[model samples]
Target: VDGEAKVGWPTPSKKLELYSKTMADWGWPEYAAPAFIRSHIHWEDLDLAAGERVLVPTFRIPTLIHTRSANAKWLNEISHHHPLWIHPEDCEKLGIETNGLVRINTGIGHFVIHAWRTEGIRPGVVAASHHMGRWRLGDDKGRSWGAGKAEIDRDAEGRWHLSRGEQQPYESADPDTGRIWWRDTGVHQNLTFPVQPDPISGMHCWLQKVRVEAAHPGDNYGDVMVDTDKSHQLYKEWLAMTRPGPGPENLRRPLWFARPVKPLATAYVYESGGTTG
Candidate 1:
């Protein structure tokens, strides 16, 4: 059966042109559709990088909240850690088993994560999602469940006492619903990615061109690479703005006088640093 086209909707070619012009105006000529269409980089263009290897990270299902979700009864049952999804054929060559740990490396960075061998991905490429590896949840110093402990001192009478230490627990409440959720925390992937700007779009391309290797069990998945040079530059800029300098320059005289007083009489005496005679 043929489906009817919706009214007021632009044709595919027109839509493509609109997108191309919009992106071009935003300084993304390289990402313009005309260039992509000519180069045959369509939805099915995964294997288009044939004979050449590339690594891409995809986002995990919404239900899972990185490695932290593993502690939750509901989300853990679904899937907690991010596993690298690789083609079955690639697994055979590398002798990698499904659910085994592997080290994914790129020219700029690398991380050790679990591997999920499946036919869902294209060969010669590996895919991983951001989020996982929460260690502080169970640690004594970490506040995975609720607030930290407070110290209190009691007298012999046990009636009254002074409290010495007070530490608030890490708390997160949804702004819209007002429901709270807790977990020992960590920063997101944006911190790990370099601040290098794309030449054409002037946008930060967080995804890096990468490589992968097998990693043993119990490896630290939280470790990630960061561009220290960019971090240092950011720190210097922040320091300059915050440091204090000169105070205000101009001062204005009061316009009105109080009861039984004159404004001009006080102004002249103060300016000359003299006392009234």
Candidate 2:
């Protein structure tokens, strides 16, 4: 028999064949190898041009520190701000001046961010960390503490009033430790990626091969369209299907309604049990 003859059905062997066949059907030739083997194509083989494709390693929002801990307040108070890190060279090529707002577009999607030029990043790429946008929960007067409350104003005439007051940023508190923190300081990279695969390997590569352009002055990057309604519907359906079942109820009550079960007892005793003076 040929060296490639079919072997007994092992789980790993079967998985490998299944993956290879799936890639073949999807037009991905580079990912047909066994899972245990390292078959990452060399960077040179991809013929990537400078500023064409880049690798971005992202982390969680710093305010939350971890996936489960982000909802806390104290963490957001100290260091939970988010910003996009971009190489100065890349900023220059896209006509994006330092610290200017720029839009990044890929074959599948796009996003806008305020550019931060840093030499620490590789020359050809940009990195946008996540978790900066947050709705303010009424707390303080400053823009960093929580979204400030909006008020309506009217002129001498009794016309309807509409005005958006500046928002105080959100401050997160750690549920377990009661520590307060800031939210904008965190890094959220997932927002910049797309749900696409590499053509050769069929490996899910979230980062996009895209271009950057300077956004018009006074333009807010968040206003750009990232996904269509159809795509959003698909994503919603997928989320509903994959989310875990609800867990136990939250037993901790809000601070305002807490009550002690019993009253404190006070004891008064003289030097002697009787009046011994």
Candidate 3:
């Protein structure tokens, strides 16, 4: 971390990379270096449903890091809810009062959550810090102060229906069980998001443009409803958007990129027309 400017960065060339040949070779010369890849959630790309808009799912509060800190009782106490943050103007436009329950519909599923109207966010944008909405399902009776449990039921044809169960009060070794403070166990909105894999990075496009509508009759907090069939449908849809499947792209991720360790040279031998492993 010290005095490496003169020696160069720990890259293949030991020089800071402005242009990534790996990206160029992989078909995205535009992003081979530093350049803005317009976010997937722009107004032009979105076909919003009534009362819906773009969602900023990565927003985080000072108290936690994504869903990992949910078990930290103190941290959870400080930040227990991932309220749907909206601009006050947009909230009015959508008829959503602060703390009002709203249903967010993703491409794959939908979840109900409380709206939080504030001037802090941009108009037409709904931000939900993803870390807070943690739940447990099936036979798992109580809120894990951290993890989740679910209630699972099967029908005549063996189709399954899963729903969120209450965080039951239970006697536990930790005295805090009796005093578990905040009960706003958030929704598992992540389930609702369909996989939008990036053609270059091999990652899900997490920033989603979704529709946020007023809660209809029978919507509840911590509610998540997914149609696995629909999810798979979207999966295939986005899968077709990728450039090429993962494998050695002429060379795997550019041998120059700094990694904790390197693989053998033979590992990078995937030919142009060969199957990607």
lDDT of 1 at 151: 30
Where does candidate 1 clash, by residue pair?
Answer: 67-132, 105-211, 106-210, 147-169
Between the candidate structures 1 and 2, which one is better when assessed by lDDT? 1
lDDT of 1 by residue, 196-249 (tens): 443332345455444456664544443444445555564454344321211112
Q: Ranking under TM-score, best-scoring first?
A: 3, 2, 1
- Give the lDDT of residue 39 in candidate 3: 69
Runs with alpha carbons beyond 4 Å of true place in candidate 1: 1-33, 37-53, 65-73, 134-142, 145-192, 216-277
What would you estimate as the lDDT of candidate 1? Answer: 0.45
Q: Local distance difference test, per candidate? A: 0.45, 0.44, 0.72
Per-residue lDDT, model 2, residue 9, is: 51
Model 1, 277: alpha-carbon shift in Å?
A: 65
**124-154: candidate 3 lDDT, tens digit per residue:** 7888887866666534354567554555555
Model 3, C-alpha of 236: deviation from truth (Å): 2.0
TM-score of each: 0.45, 0.46, 0.82
RMSD for all candidates, in order, please: 19.1, 20.5, 4.0
Per-candidate clashes come to: 4, 39, 10
Which order, best to worst by lDDT? 3, 1, 2
Extract clashing residue pairs from model 3. 20-32, 133-186, 135-148, 136-148, 136-149, 136-150, 137-149, 137-150, 138-150, 138-151
Candidate 2 clash total? 39
